[model samples]
Target: MIEPRLIDTGTARLRVMVEGAGPLVLMIHGYPEGWYSWRHQFAPLVAAGYTAAALDVRGYGGSDRPDAIEFYDMAAMVADVIGVADALQPDAPVILVGHDWGAPIVWYSALTHPARVAAVAGLSVPFTGVPTRPLGDIFRRAFTDRGRFFYQEWFRAPGPAEEEAERDVRGYLRRLYYAISGDAPPGSWPEKPAGATLLDGLVDPDPFPAWLTDGDLDHMVAELERSGFRGPLNRYRNHERDYAWAQAWQGQRIGQPALFIAGTRDPAAFGFGAYSDPLTVMRPHVPLVEGHMLDGCGHWTQEERPAEINRLLLDWLARPPLRL
Candidate 1:
């Protein structure tokens, strides 16, 4: 069982779920997910002889939610990671594992504060080094410029997406989660013109996939209901600001041992990543990098394939660079 505690990051208080005791491995969840997203890996990580700490990122779950959009920027989030690590294990640099938006967060943490992060692994998203342009501009040029629908563009504004998501949190979560999962058919995400909203054409599966149970959906919905969507959606609104802040480190590489995992079917792995070859794009920045693309897997890497991810993680953790 995992023990829950609140970690004071000085800037924000994050609710973290921890298990076992050894070298610390801090896991950060992405958008719309809490510490519970990493629940499947805790036991296996502990059995492999490591302390597994999964945190609900600021603004999600019980974590502190700051009001300003700028508070959720990449720099601020990286500070939270460092503060949490400082509190959890002061003597040694800690391992960091993140997924989705959490992927970029951990990537920036390692990039900006190399001495604080020993090794980093990201699921579903790969680190392609510091950005030269804002992500919003990239997506707009690719999608909105061509009159196509991109979810991030829909999420660019704060109000409408929140209303749609908060109006029926359960339904919104079900569709949002299912549409991008492995179980969904190709194009299950739906095709729409640029004018459409994010949830305009998505469908909720009659019976949700086994990986995400009814109880799981219930827990996620309940969390969102309490926290609201402003803090989470605000993350998307900061692309230009994040890009500006990252310019100082424009040509820098991670300079750490790194691992990347993604599903063949996951759009984020390819579409959003804007590359057919992830390792190629990642290697220049993360020289000592290892990657795996799970067959038929989707966005929710650990959740959908816990056993596989656990084995891979254990094997990687035991590698010479990361081995204690």
Candidate 2:
């Protein structure tokens, strides 16, 4: 059984779903998602003899949604993770696991407070070489090769995208979720088909993955509809802020036992160039690193292939930490 708890994380009140008993494990979800995104791994990790908790990061689910973009800054988000650890397991450090946007937070947490994380695993998103360039340079690097870079900028644009998304949130969310999950036409990754903007009007009778049922979509729709798109979209608006903070830690390496799990078909795998040279970029910082590419899967690795994700988590947890 999963038990829900609210922890005061100073910046916001974060709601978490926790279960089991052993070394603490903290799970972070990505944008347009909540702790329910980790529903597949919760009980499995618990049965494997680890106390696991999946957090609804600030601004989503039951967590307080602050109104300011600065409030969603990397430092504040990382602090929420640290605060959760402090409130739940004051004496022991946690095994950090994150998906999508959550992966970035894990990377930051491990970098900022290495001692607080026992072992770290990132799903769908891998640790790119840290921010060593200005916001414009980062944008250019991200999009330099073909249309690889426009999507990130699209999210940051303060115009129709956000407005349309907020107009009919339920439909907009369904399309966004589908787009990332590989429901679009072939070769949709490197570049979207001609005239296919990311935030274009919702397709009639949206094509969501079969793996995600109406109940799952309903959960996402309800949360996003009530909260609107601002809270989540604001996460993208802080790219400059994140870049500035990450620049402070340039050349800093995260020395934790790290693992990255990617869906072979996930756009982000190739979109961010994470799969291109993961060993060179990730292994340098996290010396003890492991990578898994799940076949026939998309961005939503946990939901698309729950059993595989569960096995990966169990195996990673079994491995001893670097200094333990």
Candidate 3:
């Protein structure tokens, strides 16, 4: 059984779901997602002898929502992870794991606080080291300047995004989950002109891929209804700031044993990641990195392929290298 706890991370309180035993494994979900993203992994992880815990990273779900965009900064987000670890394990080494936005947070956490994180794993997004160029400029050049639609760029402006998303929460979630899902038709999440909104020409599958259920969809819709999209979208607003903040730690590699898992079809796998070959791109920054590419899966790696994700995570966690 999963137990829900409101953890006081000193700065911001977060809603965390925890289960299992043995070494601590902290799970963090990405943008537009809450701790429920890791629902499938909790029991399996517990059975595998792990204290698997997932948190509602700051702005989503029952976690505290700070209004300022800057409040959701990388430092603040990473602090929440560390604070939860300190509270639960009190300086004990933690096996850090995350997906999407959470992936980078945990990577940065492990990079910045290696003493606290014994080893780390990321799903979807990979650590590409400090940004050589600001992402905003890159996005503008790649999408905006060329009059193409980019979801990240669409999210940069708070007002329009919140307004459109809040206008129809369920529909928005449906389109997003379906379009980027592995089951989507070839043209589901294709690029569009810059002026288009996120929902323009978006289609929602009649049955969301089996990985996601109506109950799961309802949970996300309900939470989003309460939280709105402003805080969540603000996460995208900080790329430039995040890039600037990382100047202090340039050229640092994640020395700890690390694993990366993502659906082969996930946009982040090749579409958005700096390098089509994740291992090649990540090797320079994360030398110890190893990865698994799930066949026919999309952006939502954990939810899309829960059983496989659990297996990979457990097996990797048990490796002798991670023990030392």
Candidate 4:
């Protein structure tokens, strides 16, 4: 794997790794992960005649880590991505692929800066329109107030989450990756009752899941240990602010060719609120929306099923669609 070099986005300096030379494909990764998360797809995308570039989002890895939680807001995150895209190829639209938080970043970037994005693909997250209410309130009502545990709430606090996770990075990564994988042991992911911690009921599997290797865990841990979990966890504290910022674009559509992929076992695909039907929710905003749900896969869709993902991407990108 090639080492990532730094690129100065107008708002933030990001560490980016590029492969091949052609139309640009800017990849964004999710929470608790770095540019390394998208390493598998870089060569394949380049082989298919596209410039595949993956970058470290702010607050993770080699990117700038702002101290305040507000710096990690969706508004700033969107600006960072737009800046990166513009810096890579000014005024030239690029295809975007993102998973987890990166998914929301690209999705919102498409809406806010439609001219900068030619085509967009979101993994593990679906664009379900602007929320009428703040997500924190909703989550609190559904989980916290109901005497249940919600991961976001547990992460909303700045220091506590960071302390626990950073204190035991290995344990945190192992338990987190395993619990969300396709092979989570039976009863390994039961719902936590009211007043339970995020780590409650989480099991760190014996040999780790097949999708993730010991080497991969080490890499993630090394990067995460450099800059505790503060910046990453701060993202959870901005639900109200994000909803407020998104109000300006209420009822706006993506108006670009888009692809959505998610693992059937991923909670974002079906377990969450009213997000079970992503296509139905996306068609209104993106007219050219095409999607696939991989069976037996989990949160790490690209890593868990790289070959199939490469084939799907090659076929889709080669086919007629929006281009700049």
Instruction: Report the alpha-carbon TM-score of model 1 versus the true structure.
Output: 0.98
C-alpha RMSD (angstroms) for model 3: 1.3
TM-score of 3: 0.97
| Among all candidates shown, the one with the greatest TM-score | 1
| Local accuracy by lDDT, each model | 0.91, 0.77, 0.87, 0.84
Report the error of model 1 at residue 256, Å: 0.9
Query: Which scores better on TM-score, 2 or 4?
Result: 4
TM-score per model over all chains: 0.98, 0.89, 0.97, 0.96
Model 4 pairs in collision: 147-194
Model 3: per-residue lDDT, tens digit, 1-324?
A: 889999998999999998877889999999788999998888887887888899998889999988899988788888999999988788578999999999999999999889999899999888888778778888788878888888889899879998999998988988988888888977888778899999998897786777788898899999988887778888898888888888789888899999999887888767464467777788899988889988899899889888899889888988886642
> Which lDDT tens digits does candidate 1 get at residues 1-324?
798889998889998888899999999999888889998999989998899999999999999998899999998899999998998899999999999999999999999989999999999988888878898988999989999999999988879988998999999988988888999988887778999998888998898899999898889999989999989998998999999999999898898989999998788988564899888889999998899999999899999999888889889999997886
Question: Ten consecutive residues with minimal summed lDDT in candidate 2?
Answer: 187-196
Which prediction has the highest lDDT against the true structure? 1
Q: Rank the candidates by lDDT, best first.
A: 1, 3, 4, 2
Q: Write the per-residue lDDT of candidate 2 for residues 1-324, one digit (tens) a residue.
A: 899999987768999999999878899999778899998887888887888899888888788888788888888889999999988898977889999889989988998898888778898877765766655456556564444536656667556556777687667666666666645554444455323456654352444567788898788778767666666777888877888888878888888788898876686666455346554567777777898888768898888889998988788777765322
